[model samples]
Target: MARIERVDWLMVDLAPKVPRSDAIQSFVSQETPIVRIIDSDGAVGTGYSYTIGTGGPSVMALIERTLAPLLLGREAEDLEALWRDVLFVTHATTVGAITAIAMAAIDTALWDLRCRRAGLPLHRLAGGAQASLPLYTTEGGWLHLEQAALVDDALAARAAGFAGAKIKVGRPLRQDVVRIGAVRAAVGDAFEIFTDANQAFHVDEAIRRARAYQELDIGWLEEPLPADDIDGHARLAAMTTIPVAVGESIYSPAHFREYLQRRACSVVQVDVGRIGGITPWLKVAHMAECFNVAVCPHFLMELHIALCAAVPNARWIEYIPQLDAITTQGMRIEAGRAYPSEAPGLGIAWDWAAIDRLAIGAGQVTLGSSGGKR
Candidate 1:
């Protein structure tokens, strides 16, 4: 057994060249908190989680103060054991965002350790369901973009061999219809087009917009209502033939269970960081499989490509290029499909230089083999 030896973390605030807005908020930066773990045999694994320009320091603090200590001196033999120990220790604050975000760093680093030691890639380590899946982009479809720009992006994506593009919705009914229609006209009917409201509507308004969306043959309507409104989501799902997608905001597996049991959402967009980590992320995907719903994760294409490929029910992976600023290379995407890294471990080559450059350097600490910050 490899005994846990040391762990450390830092926060990197990666700014987008152009700030983008959705129905809810503007994404100023990818507030990234990074964690690295080293075991007794000297194997090192890295992991990270992101917020939309906030709470990164809080995540780092939790990791440094509580989570990192819990990891030191334990056997890294069981990922679930390590995950549960961290989960319950922060139980009071959890079933919420900050705790889950902090735990994600530790949980992901542990997976990196497992994959590297086994000489296998993450998809195979998780479940080995597939090596590739279709890819879609949200980069060009931000709510702030003009309709013509949206059309241009969709056309460009199709030309570049992307399977689809997700356009943000939640505008006035007629305007939303026109924007989608314009993109459809530009990209043609063969290229799939998805729409997201980012929880911008009530059930009634969501229904109205969804009906309009159905006429365009939209691939799916994502997060049409607030995540907590299972009853509203169920109603919206039942009323429209268009599949309703949710899960980015839902924190725990139990909450996802609530949506699935109620038949509220048809597509599960399970996010690795938001739902704790790969440990619980996989659980939710398998859970969605029981009901025959597809898993198309929210963001983090680099990591989600493998996670989505790990599950049999997953068909598509959302492509939002958040880590490009901090990573040495981007994931492989060809002919409108995404392929996971075949390199052993979670194949992300972090640009430590870039990370350190953007890192806020707060709550940063190091625990040595014997314990305590050194």
Candidate 2:
């Protein structure tokens, strides 16, 4: 019986870079608390959970104190069973970012284990829907940047072989229009233009800006207002010709249900970390599929590429090169399209040496190891 052996949580800190524009909170530098799982034969699998500054400590604690102990010596082959088992044990309090981080850490590791065992790439192991997925640039689109610098950023992405580029919005309706117009003019109408407000505006303002950029052919208006405002998203979706997009901050399947039920978004932007791990995220993606909604996954893009490729409806995946500094063999994007690796697991592995160097001891991870209820 090949059973589980050990789980280790490794923390890696990223260097500071340009801050994302509209979020009330932003990361100074990315911190990834990677979970590594080794089976009885010493086969290893690795997964990453999303962690900003404040959330990592709690997430790490939950895994180390609550989850690790439960998983020890379990059958490595029972991936789905283990996922449900974890949820079952923590059913009472398993929700929100903490649940997301914990589940992502383990679920992703399970997936890595599955793929490695199969000697297949992550996408193929999940049932490859397509060989290569199209990509878009999410880097260099900050409203905080000077107009000239913003334009330069867009132009740089275009020159770097990106077919599409997204820029930040939510300053004022007119400023968004001007920025979108400039990007369109610079890149020409042939290239795809996308924008994200990061939920900074109100409902009426979101509608107004979406309408304003209609002429520039903006691909989608992402998170125009806070995620809680279902009516607002519905209103914006109905009022504007451009597609309304949301989901980075959304917490649960219930949250996604509201958007799908109301037809609130033309696009579903699922963030694997923000919505829990691969299991729940796949559920969300399937929900989007049922509703005939296009999915442009939010961030932590390495895993997203595999998810996108696994489903037929997935559109463009976001590209922010800043994460390359932390990852060992970073993803390669060419001509605006991201190509998945042929590696046995999730393709790229974490730079553990670099991770240890970056570890700050600000967080902890615990896993329940006691025997299961069965």
- Local accuracy by lDDT, each model: 0.87, 0.77
RMSD of each: 1.6, 3.4
Local error of candidate 2 at 114, Å?
1.2
lDDT by residue for model 1 (1-374), tens: 68887787778877885658988899987888888888899988888888988888788878878888888778876899988898899999988889988888888889998899888999987889987999888999999999989989888899899989999987788998999999988888899999999999998899888887899999999999988899999999899999999999988999999999999999999899999998999999999999999999998888998888788999998878878888898899888898999988887878988877776754433445333333
Write the residue-wise lDDT of candidate 2 on 1-374 in tens digits: 46777777755667546676553555565667677788877788888876666677677777777776667878878877888888887788756677777878888887888788778988887768877777777667776776677778778877877778788886767777887787788888777888888888888777667767888888888888988899988888888889989999886888998899998998999888777677778888888999999889897778888888888889888886545666678786766678788888888766666676676543322234432211
> In model 2, what lDDT does residue 63 have?
76
Best by lDDT: 1
Superposed by TM-score, candidate 1 places the C-alpha of residue 303 at a distance from the truth, in angstroms, of 0.4
Model 2: residue 275 alpha-carbon error in angstroms = 1.6
Model 2 quality (TM-score): 0.92
The runs of at least 3 residues in candidate 2 whose Cα sits more than 4 Å from the true structure, single-residue gaps closed, are: 362-374
CA lDDT, candidate 1, residue 22? 88
